[model samples]
Target: MHAIEKQKSPMQSLAESVLDAHTANFWLQKINPLWSVSQPLGKIIEIQSAATDTVSLKIKVNRHFLMGKAGQHHPVIVEIAGRRYERTYSLTQLDQYHVLLTVKRIAQGVVSQWLCNTAKVGDVLHFGQPYGDMTVTPEQQPALILLAAGSGITPMYSLLKALDYSNKISTQTITLMYWVKQHADAAFANYFESLAQQHANFKVHIFHTQEAPCDARLNKNHIDFIKDLSNSTVYACGPSGFVNTAEQLFTSAKNFKSEAFSLTPIISDEGGFINVTLTKSNKTIAIPKGQSILVGLEQQNIQPQHGCRMGICNKCSCNKVQGATKNLVNGVENTEPRNSLRICVNSAQTDLIIDI
Candidate 1:
């Protein structure tokens, strides 16, 4: 058994030898523009407009691509003006070979606007491994409550479609409550409505927050929906405010989940400054108690590598050699040494030394 397990196939041995640094540099220079040694790459196969300011890019992934779960997100790398920027987006698998990335343009979102307006087919892009936990298997629950607002419907859309297409949603009650500013901003409305008409247990409620006569928003007053909280697994996504509101309302639900990527400024009630030392760079600065370390470093003209600007991406996570820090999201303080923390959403509470 040990001898059989230790044997390598001929193709595996060839691949291992070919991918080594000494041999790969020759082949890398030929095809490295669209490929990387450390990450997977994909090429855009098609681009379709989803809504007024949104577009979905269908990509064909390479062999290095790691398939993500139903509601996971991938960080994409794009170069603009000779500078590379990274942005994360939820993925919707179209098939084994293809996946869709839905991007909505924000007011000042550089990567989003470029992807929505300027990106085209056949463009090769780099992608980080996918990660997230807002997923559900068919056997997990008999009933589900999905709450989404604005662009938050991306992941919910993936989960619903995956279940329905696989014929795994029979007799399971799923209620999706989606809120958008206007009717024109709603994507996948026709597809979801068609699914609702065909499936007896699937329902969709779209709330137009900027409609002419009535603008409906989710609140504690959605009495009928709130009554079912005890028996179903509830998932909510959107801006910070929307997720926060849902969490408050469904505080006592059986199972509740939410995902938010909003980068709201950290407001601290505690007032003080802590000394922060970046050991690798040999730089020390004073960071305020209530502000994120990322913001503090930027103010001092020292920029650390980051993506999403939110905690979800984990791109700005660093090792802490010492000191106590507070997580701005949940206000949890940690004083453990040799710990990893997201610098974008954590504030220094005591003198700190970190590997940056």
Candidate 2:
């Protein structure tokens, strides 16, 4: 006897007849908001204030959503006023079917403002697959140091929760040094303090940089308390300047990993202007050689697709038809044609043509 095959329903059969997934999804979504052939979707289940300008959103993910490792980031897409906008944010997994997304509202930031003020429970959100190499593992070093400044604390918090969930927090000596402008700006302060109270090997320190007697910014003095530099693994996340300082101070440690959420464009001394031609737009613009191509294009009112804006996510990457560009992050110069170019971190070093 032949094995029996399950029969498809009329809706399912009709959906399969659609020419494209998008067309099928357009109808499928009308039946069920989370129903989709490929796109991952989440429903906001809860919202709470994380800090003065920050909010923590608990999202219940659908079956298509792929869970990410601790310390990874997800590109969150939201639709506002008939326009779609995307931004990346660090996520903390709450359970098998849910995740926590904490967002700090940025001044003049469209998505941030909408998420912070307008979004409510039961609102649906779109998510890109999680990406980022920095992740927490079980076989980490005995001593761990976490350095975070401002919104960078999100990833560090996720890593810590992972360690705690895996029962590794009790065995390893972990120290978190977090910097914020004021006490009200610190997110998850009470949670960290409670966790430290329960674990003998864990310590949490919050530094208020703008208080009356301001705590000094990340410096060599901050690591003076750690006795085992050679056996310690250090992780730092923040603005470029803060991460750079952490790298300078902790390079001697056993392992040092850092990620900068924001980068200040590395202005080159080789001053001049270069012409960049947009192949698809049929427009030519003069851009400064020292500044990033993304910044230059934005100055000329050419808004390109971008996420993170720190060169980590490749959302801003485009095809360089022909150009001599220098990477601001690593200072590497590429003169090749028909190559992938990340405009957020690369500056035009000569007259160029790009597919934008």
lDDT of 2 by residue, 1-356 (tens): 01223355578577968647888878888887877766889999999999999999999887778788898888999999999888888999888888899999989889999999999998999998888877766577899999999999999999988888888889899999999999999999998999899998898989999997899998999888677888999998888778878888888899887778766566667777899999989999999877889989999999998986777788899999997998765567999999999898788889999998
Give candidate 1's error at residue 21 in angstroms.
Answer: 5.8
Q: Rate the local accuracy (lDDT) of all candidates.
A: 0.80, 0.87
What is the Cα-based lDDT of residue 2 in candidate 2? Answer: 14
lDDT of 2 at 45: 92
Best model number under TM-score: 2
Task: Looking at model 1, report the run of 10 residues with the lowest lDDT sum.
Answer: 1-10
Candidate 1 has a TM-score of: 0.82
CA displacement after TM-score superposition, residue 136 of candidate 1 (Å)? 0.9
Clashing pairs in 1: none
- In the order shown, the candidates' Cα RMSDs to the true structure are 4.9, 4.6
**List of clashing residue pairs for candidate 2:** none
